[model samples]
Target: MGHDEPPQHQVVANDLRRRITNGEWEVGAKLPSRARLATEYRVGANVLQKAQERLIIEGLLEGRAGSGTYVAAPRERRRMVRARHREQRGGSPFRGDMAEIGRSGTWEAHSEARTPAPDGIALRLGIDTGELCVRTEYEFLADNQPAQLSVSWEPMSITGETPIVLPEMGPLAGLGVVERMRSIGMEVTTCVEVPRPSRASQAQANLLGIGLGDPVLVIERTYYTGEGRAVETADITVPDARWEVAYEFGIDA
Candidate 1:
């Protein structure tokens, strides 16, 4: 066959896809390998490989590493179950600037800022009370509303040598104080998270656009070096009605 000719792999993939959709092969059923399909369809290995990839993308097949390709499980079709579905939400919800924050379906990256740490915050960065520290503040938003305010601190003595502390460093420069420190030779091996529910203070209430008596969510995180040295600490606040917290765990065997 000519190089310009329509490859036989595509033909085989289309046929298999049609059969699966037509209920000939149910979910979890195994499919033939590139070599076997090549023989059956009188096509080259390259063509068979191409066809398999197309089926995988179309959600008609699944490929597990070291395992052979198989018919894909039918996905649970979800409809507009609610008017305020996750996808309908906008930009970073935490900040008024971003319509939604966090991931559209799950989490989103809200507002992020890098500034000099204050005296009290310096202690959290493992620096002297008066030492220089970079403070990166993030407000996680959900569906374009404030979910949480996360403030991270890092000693300028550690990251000062890098441009990550610069004013116009741009977003995503130093995602979190821990990651930024790691980029400059400091490895954070431990993290401590503290969660609490309380009322938003006057300043916090202003930032969050909530009343003083309103219930709020607060989270504090501290990142530490390998030797139990605390490298950074964060204080976050979130309004209760605007944010939802989700956590999942998987144990390694």
Candidate 2:
């Protein structure tokens, strides 16, 4: 198409995007069929399809591999980090920690264990054949919207005896495993933090009140206890709209 022709697909995408972003079509609203959109925009079906793809990339829409596309809802954001390190090591400063969030909002917890753990989770927990890690999940809400989805793993050796590491047990009970172990006389000497790009799953969408396949920020942290023994690992999913994280650096000079 010539510059004067206007990018037909882009024009179609922008109109739909504006509607979705402006909440004209609420989240989960089914978009018009390709033929319908093409007819309305006076463009070809292929052009309409390309327009839908653009909205999907912008996180304004969700498309099933085979199903249709739908308007995407907003998601709350979350920030997670080790409280002690942030406080003592002069890292990023935060207004709150897990405790503060837990106290201020509604949250739920689920825990269970199953043999033959799921793929990489099994290896990370160091469970040999026939063994499984005790997994606990927390869905935290802020101002009534799902703010964070977090999953923590503990070897059978630790959580098995308790069935759960309940919050009532104290901060460590609900804290990152490293701090918990330290409170129990096992010092946490090492940790690993990994973050990568990922899309929100249906479960996460349900919790965050967003349409399926929304974007999410994923953080994975592993903690080591006394003598460098791997103690626990946690996978945290944060919705970008409501969450943010910061890191601070100091100059020795």
Candidate 3:
């Protein structure tokens, strides 16, 4: 192969991508069968399969398990903004986040007994490995459609025996992290966020309705107390096919 030449699969994917983007194939329209497409492109079925897989990862195509491949509908790109000042006002971040994206949101959260923190989670929350911590899993929905998923951890050393320990089983139930910590006299003052793009894990893909290996945005966030102690940390997942994560600040009053 010439150094300047692109891979055959990539070349096929580009041609298909162009057709989809150009509206040659309207959204939700089925593409030619693999055998037919391979013959049309003068490539083997294996090569064409690889090409369609690229489009699938790019959100330009979707393959239904038994229904063959089709052009994907244009997804609504919901903006996910992280403006510190807005959150300082104190409320459910999930609710506000969805509203900003022009959708009504609800979530189902399940909290579990305090358990030994995993090494990665402990490091993020600034706790020792095997230390007791409260874990909560959340599935956030916009208009009843799954939009995001998260898993959060808070060290039991800080919340143990407190009314806020369960996170969703007290007077402070459903309150945001900053507010919940405040109710227990821990003043949460700063939050740090690190964002990265990664292939969707099977669990995430199942919940978000995207194929495995599709792009998704993962946010690792930690809230700190006034004394710089990490109070809580969470891994937030949003399917990139359906949301556009953005950082907003400096709003004029």
- Using lDDT as the measure, the top candidate is 3
Model 1 scores worst on lDDT over the 10 consecutive residues at 79-88
User: What C-alpha lDDT values do all the predictions have?
Assistant: 0.60, 0.66, 0.87
Residue 128, candidate 2: alpha-carbon lDDT = 60
State each model's C-alpha RMSD to the native: 18.6, 8.7, 5.2
By descending lDDT, how would the candidates be arranged?
A: 3, 2, 1
lDDT by residue (tens digit), candidate 1, 51-109: 88777755678788989999988643222111122212332222222223223322333
From the highest TM-score down, the ranking of the candidates is 3, 2, 1
At residue 157, what lDDT does model 1 achieve? 66
lDDT of 3 at 45: 90
What's the residue-level lDDT of 73 in candidate 1? 80
lDDT (Cα) of model 3: 0.87
The collision pairs in model 2 are: 77-242, 77-243, 78-243
